[model samples]
Target chain A: MERPEAPEGAVWAEHVAPDGYTHRVLARGTVFRLANPEGGACAHVLLHHVDQPWERLNVADTVKVQWNAYGGHLLLSDQGRVLASVESESGYDALCGTTPKGRDMFVRAAAKHGLGKRDLPPSLSFFQGARVRPDGSLHFTGPAGDVVTLRAELPLVVLIANTAHPLDPDGACTRLEVTAWRDQPTGPDDPLWTATPEGRRAFENTHEYLSARGSA
Target chain B: MTVVAANAGWSALIGAGQTLTIVDLEGNQAVDFLVYSAADTAERYSAQDTITAQGNIFLTTGSVLMSNERNPLMTVVEDTCGRHDTIGGACSKESNTLRYGHHTRPQHACVENFLAEGAKWGLGKRDLVSNVNWYMNVPVEQDGTLGIVDGISSPGLKVVLRAEVDVIVLVSNCPQVNNPCNGFNPTPVRLEVA
Candidate 1:
């Protein structure tokens, strides 16, 4: 797979092969981008708060609050905190969780890294499509190769696994390219600096926690 | 190896042939659990496989946790808490609001606990699964309905599992306060491995 050019000013970048995984700790205000360079790849992503490690991204909350599962949304933390804002050009799958086929490949890849099951979490199936039918069954869809960019709301520890979605017809995997760069400072008028009512409250709560810990 | 606080999360990697015991230091604390293959993230615990193989929904002594691939990951070697829930999934802020009210939204839940603890090991929300609710009481009614009720366990009750493969175990000392599942209060639990 050919490597995609990193965004200008990118501080670091890496390409994850099929069935590979990578973990990184990103600073707040960083723009982290994951792109399926060869198409037909799924990058399962997870995030956690750097200071309060227990407050991590809540995928279910992300869907419930938005009332939609499509891409281009804010991923919320369990405390209603904004972990990251997701902007995807290729879309994501909301109905399907990680499948046995994907898990098998991840296991093989993890073994090479000396990581155990504790290191494996379910994924937010990126660049894949599936919908829940009225009858409760799922219908898989295709057309991969989307770039998903996440702008961090807080310092985060992120994990991404590159693998095939269960619904992929050929079960084939492709390479995933990741680019991370410090985002330009946002002014008060910038959307990134604005918050929803709930988000504002969450931010306040986080501030309180930090203040209590003498870290604010 | 760890003593998880009430409403907290804990995680560990248990190799093949190792046994891990969870002690309910205080009775009635629901311990939410998820397990994955140490070597493969995808080959994790499957509630469907375990339920199908056992022909039962409750986990107990001798019950083997089957992965999504229908392979055994861990076997329940001993149990003082006679039954554990296989379907009462980890609690989350969403579920708390849906089941109780919006007022419960700010409360910490099992999902947060799992994510927080699992993150230390590089695990995330995408890795959560239909977990085992150790010490939780979810009784299935004759009409196929399920009820999360007061637990039957007493203080010091324990359950043990022997890993069939190298596996990672993630746990949440369930912080649910909206229901009787945790007796309206969450408490600490003890974890020991041999």
Candidate 2:
């Protein structure tokens, strides 16, 4: 398959083959983008503080805290810090993908970083979503092209798997293109700095930790 | 009815359609719960699927506990604690030290309970998932901040769950001493199945 062109200013980019996974450490303020070219692909993403493995992505906290599952929302760490935020999104699917395939992909990625199966936590999916009907039953939306960018708020260990969403009626997935580029550090002047009181506190936590380490 | 001592753990195989009731013998105690297929431990409780299917974070009566495969492991047939938490994950030495200080590292926590009991069933750390905190109060503040405040449950308060399948139930009578989730002090609970 022909690889797509790298996005402008990308520090690095790669097209992960279908059913494959990738892991990398991205710096704070890096703009990490995941693009599903075929539109049917779903991606399972896991993140942790690049330096602190104990502080990892907490999907339940992300959904429970925001009360929404949109693609471009605050991705929170278990320790109450904003690891990343959806800077922009084209397709909405923040479903938690628990399929063995999705988890195994991350398991492989985690192992490369010296993390074991037990270290892997629940992950959030992209490019597929579901809605609750009036009857309390779920109605899954069809696959859609996912072009989402997440702004890292903390230096992060980004792990991603391009795998089929377990609930996808079609059960089809393809390659995913990931690109990382440098961006200006977030400051009080940025709208996202204090978007919401909850986000503000998360940012404060992130910033405080960074400053304590002399990274901020 | 089986009495679970404070800071201890228990596991059992509840038959399909059987009801298991957990009573907070002492008010304000947090009971961490998990359910897995008796025939296949791989199909363990999934907080994501359960919360996604129900469109609600707090579980109460009439809630169906969904598995990773999207099947019902159990249902909240009866609940008197009003609401239960599914997001505040089981505590561990790592989390204890992260939330509290490193000095609290030696304290026993829910993950240790799950690991000890789950190991008896051939389950390992990978088998555990986010668990239900019954009688524990975790309120999502208006600003979306989660607070582990004192419990809303009182003495004798219980929640009943009916196994939708022959299921293995694992529980940790939460021993957390660092938070208000257990009132900073753990206590005993009662369990009965019929």
Candidate 3:
């Protein structure tokens, strides 16, 4: 089901790069940040609109796409629209190979960013284990939980499928929640998020109109 | 707007609110860099973590840089020119020999510069990982391949990273003459850490 055929007039919403593969966008305005392994510029698709309409979709805005052998609707966004989607691909074991696994660092940073321990979805399964390092490459936990080791060099994105314990009933796969920058809290304690440049401009105009109304 | 130059061998520390600007006074210079936790030098920049967090193969402005332990290292505050390289890992001795002719194995590269400087502050080889090529450009081919192309960066072009915390910065004005990344003319660079 690679390149699941989209219906007519369907906007190219987002680009998905499967495990062991790299997906590049020919359009601009499509911004992509690495999911787990997290440090690189916001990779923009070569199109004029980087953010697709799919990014704004919520639970009801489900557009069926081929998921791990099946399609399911999961709670996608929040009131603030920070989180755009909650994806779970079954039957395929994949990993955010670049991200760290520990909760301590994640907790600390999340707290600083207003994402407390409670913020993480309670339904999310957690894992705490060290990966086996093979001769020169990294060792991975396969979809069947078998230790598959390889000797690869640095700067590599590695994903092992068919883990014994899939995050869901289907095989393991990377679940990414598409997000927006402006909707996210600036800091843990900060109640208000920073608005984008356009948002800020609109806010100012609205505030001015309200002020004038109050005076009149 | 700010300029700092690096002599043959030098290091600098960049603090918060201030940005470190690297300039290639002469064209074709590759700047090798390493970042560490200012509060604790034990933990260093982790390439895997960074790549995962950012969700891309390259680094440039607007990227919220992450550390190995999954901490925010810095953010690309501003960039006059766009498109930096994150997939093209820093150059090393073995790579120098392999990429170039075997006889060019002895060339000093960004990797060595990072290790040597980090050692001065109690860092080591394990600390080195993926880095951002500020002005370097590598375009993917039609077949989904990568090639080091002539840089799209020009003189006066700069990339800025705002420190999320007090960060220790190390950079080596690249001396690689083998590829077009450095314009076949590795030159000195300016370092401004204010």
Candidate 4:
């Protein structure tokens, strides 16, 4: 995996080879972006608030609460708070699987932090996406140079493992690059929070939780 | 046969083609249930696959629980309660504290039960996933908001499942005292193998 140059003045950047993983404690308002330069490289990502690991990513509630799984949607915690919002995406995927799976890799990454299997929850995958039919049929859409950007709505620990996603068909993932930059966090005044009734409620839950602690 | 005490846990290596009957001996008790392939625990119940396959979230009689690999692990053979919840996952102290407040942090939760009971089989936290909440009622509105409310089941109501393969079954009789899912009162249930 060739290393890509980090963007100028970027907070952080890293090249994740196939079978490699990374974890970072990012502050609220971090603009995190992941790219599949060569394609077929799926990132099985997990997230938890830096201060509160219990409020981790819940893919079930994320899909159920949003009623749709796609880019620009809010990914929620089981407690109904918006952990991060998929701000933009090209190769969109909602599933993870196959060899060196995100699940096992996640366990290892979590264990590094003294967090075990119990700390992990269902997560989202990027790079290889699926477009489903009404009858429950679906196919993959893995495009090269695909990218996704996520805006953290809270201080969080973002973990990424370059693992195979079932839709990729490669049975193994490839090299990927990630970079995080500073940005303004999503707040109640932000339209991202008021986009939908569901989004609004989730943001409200997030807002109340944050406000109670005097966090702006 | 096992009479799981109130707020206790139970498990079994259910053989393929055999059925395990879960009787809600006391009404409104939410049972948090999880299952894994006895041959390869990596293949465990995937709520995503199950809901995707069924085109619905609520599980009931005839619902085939699917694994993360998209294979059927079990089938609901009988469901007198009619609808079971795959959306309202097992509760935990972390979540209990998040929702109810810090005072409830010491209270036992379904996650603890799974960890303690699952340890007997060499399983740990990594093995737990979004679990089935038997007899728990979580209504989803058109806006996708979920409300964990009182159950529709009554005392002695039963839900039975036949193993589609050799599988390890783990259960936590939900001890949540913060929500109405268990009517804020925990109780015991009965499990019978046939």
Candidate 5:
């Protein structure tokens, strides 16, 4: 008998967070040990908010959480269904402040990550423009330079764009991790994505950002 | 090693074996993408299929990514580094307010760049789903957890992908500096495909 190969295409590596930094999963737990030196010191810690299944949030409920400019994590799970997004901030505090105001920032960021700017209330202000690639990597630079590469899974894989540095020796990259469940479990179209205002906002953001851009 | 160019006002086609590259000429950027079937739009990129086929969270070289209609969109033909985040999702206004503060809610995000460039293409919300963060490192713990870590890529690193079929690409250079994913300092990147 052979042990099953871990989920295919799973990634594993260290990560940063708010409370402190942990090289752990982008979801639960914290901290992961790096196998080499270039991996950097595992010191940056960020905060995360895991949605409670028992909580039944409806559109009437105040949008409980959002992730605006700061960098943080958001996971949407309903048994097998799930949707997750990460927010990037300009200032550290703006990313994961604990104060009600801090959490609000995450909520806003989450909103922007999940829903589109138009979905925001008049009272809610917003800025836009982040890029994502078909390979699942986001592009924040421009049309002809280095690109940051991001992926979701155990030991997640992040690649540098253009030059094949330590990350890409041949200037091309392709690896597989087996940690993620093969079954999609759930998707953005699922009702679970927008049961509450917050969820609706997230779904809205997802819809807006994930669409294709046309020639201007 | 190979380069592909998309004129500001135009688009190009990338066939299988022909990998398309998007570069962040500067730094600290994000790219938005839409994967459509060379045959039909109805069979577009399905984040669900991509995840299910890969059986993992993040994507990288060697990962044969699938589309919504169960078609292979693009294969991770080559990757410099080895970490990517599939669950971290993207940036937006609502997320800005929720993650930062209501005061910072108006800050620019990825969705804006996507729509600003995508609106004319006839793409809409119905086309959104699971996306891959190329340089981003969102790790999972032994107990099944996740978090964003520093990027595995440095300046000039590239992730190469071969289109299984003709696929359209959209990108937004990320402008976020608050997180370590960009070392708290969002920088520019370069894109080249041939």
Candidate 6:
């Protein structure tokens, strides 16, 4: 993985190669962005509260609370805490889940880096489009360039792995560029801060936890 | 190769042809487990697939863990605990609140143990799935209802698994105190790889 040139005034940037992975702890109010420079690429993203590790992102809860599996909004933690809210996304499919091949490849890649299965968390598949049928099978629609920006609600330890979704046909690995910067407060009335009822609860829980711990 | 403390979590890479023996060091303890194909993180242990393939809800000697992809990841080669629950699943804060009470929310649970331990290897919550509860005695009533009862396993009981492929196994020394699965008190377990 080569370090990418950060945009003007950005905190950090990196270019993740195919099968490459990166883990970083970003402070709350950080704006992180992932851009698929090439058309066909997907990244698996996992988020955890930096301090309260147990209070981590729960994909099931996120899906259930919003009744949507598409990734373009607030990602909720198990405690109903908002970990990160999507600022923008392009070229990603929200409907398709992980494919056996994609999962296997990620596991192998993690193993090579001395990480085991436990490290292989479920990720929000970004940039691969698909539609699910009535029978629970997924059909790939097409491919496009996907770029997503997220605002961290709590200090988070995020893991991003450059992997393909099962819907993707095997091809040359695509390059992924990531950038992060400090974000200014957009206030409580911002839609990003008030996306869903569950998100509001999560934010409250996080705030309460922080306040109780004297970290607020 | 590891001794998972009571209410803690342990994870390891068990290569193909390797065997992992889990011992009930203090007896009547439940060890929650999840496995994935080392080659692909997506190919993870699936309780539904395994139960459907074996026609049994309880895992024992000779039970082959089937992955979501319907591939074998590991095979149970030895068992002194008699049976393990594939349906009880791991204890989580949500489940704790639902079954026990909201007061139990702050109590530690298996999902917490898994996330805390798994983070060391980059795992997050999305990786969690229906997990195997070793030493737990969740019996299916004739009407298809399930009951969490006292474990059939005593001290010194053990179960062993042989990895059919290079695999990663995650274990949560269950911290569930609101249920009889851990005898209402969680304890340590021993992991030996051979």
Give lDDT tens digits, candidate 1, residues A106-200. 45554554444544433467877655332223446675656787888677777777776665667777888888999832234656444554444
Estimate the overall C-alpha local distance difference test score of candidate 5.
0.39
The alpha-carbon lDDT assigned to residue A58 of candidate 5 equals: 13
* Lowest summed lDDT window (length 10), candidate 4 chain B: B138-147
What lDDT tens digits, residue by residue, belong to model 6 across residues A1-216?
Answer: 567777688886998877766667888889998887787667767677777665565654454344444443777666656788775445233333455545565556545544555554344667665543432234555555567888888888777777666555563358778899998533467775566554555565666766798967
Please compute the TM-score of chain B alone for each predicted structure, in the order given: 0.97, 0.98, 0.87, 0.98, 0.82, 0.97
TM-score of chain A of each: 0.79, 0.91, 0.23, 0.88, 0.25, 0.82
Off by over 4 Å in 4: A1-7, A11-29, A33-44, A48-56, A60-120, A125-179, A182-216
Question: What is the CAPRI rating of model 5's predicted complex?
Answer: incorrect
- How is the predicted docking of candidate 3 categorized under the CAPRI scheme? incorrect
Expressed as tens digits, the lDDT of each residue in B1-194 for candidate 1 is 78888888888889999999999998988999999898886678876457546655578988999887779999999999888876556778755654455588789988888878778877776577668899987664422234577898889999999999999998888888877888898999999989
Indicate whether candidate 4 or candidate 5 has the larger TM-score: 4
Q: What does candidate 6's lDDT look like per residue over B12-75, in tens digits?
A: 9889999999999989999999998888876788764575466555789989998877799999
- In model 5, what lDDT does residue B128 have? 38
lDDT per residue (tens digit) for residues B1-194 in model 3:
33334324455566766677666665545566667778786455554455445554456677776765568877887776666655455665544443443466677777677777877877664345455566777553322234577887777666677888888877766666777888887666666665
How does candidate 6 score on lDDT?
A: 0.71
Clashes of each: 9, 0, 48, 5, 222, 12
Instruction: Give per-residue CA lDDT, model 4, range A46-67, as digits (tens).
Output: 8888786866887655654554
Q: Tell me what TM-score chain A of model 3 achieves.
A: 0.23
**TM-scores of the models, in the order given:** 0.55, 0.69, 0.50, 0.66, 0.46, 0.55
Q: Which stretches of candidate 5 lie over 4 Å from their true place?
A: A1-216, B1-13, B23-32
Location of the lowest summed lDDT over 10 successive residues in candidate 2 chain A: A130-139
Model 2 whole-model lDDT (C-alpha atoms): 0.78
Cα lDDT for residue B40, candidate 3: 80
Model 4: per-residue Cα lDDT over B1-194, one tens digit each = 88999889888899999999999997999999999999988788887567656655678988999887678999998899988877657777645544555567689888889989899989876677788999987665432345677889899999999999999999999998877878788888999999
In model 6, the runs with Cα more than 4 Å from the true position are A1-5, A52-55, A89-116, A184-187, B1-194
lDDT at A193, model 1: 41
Q: How many clashes does the backbone of model 3 have? A: 48
Candidate 5 local lDDT, residue A150: 22
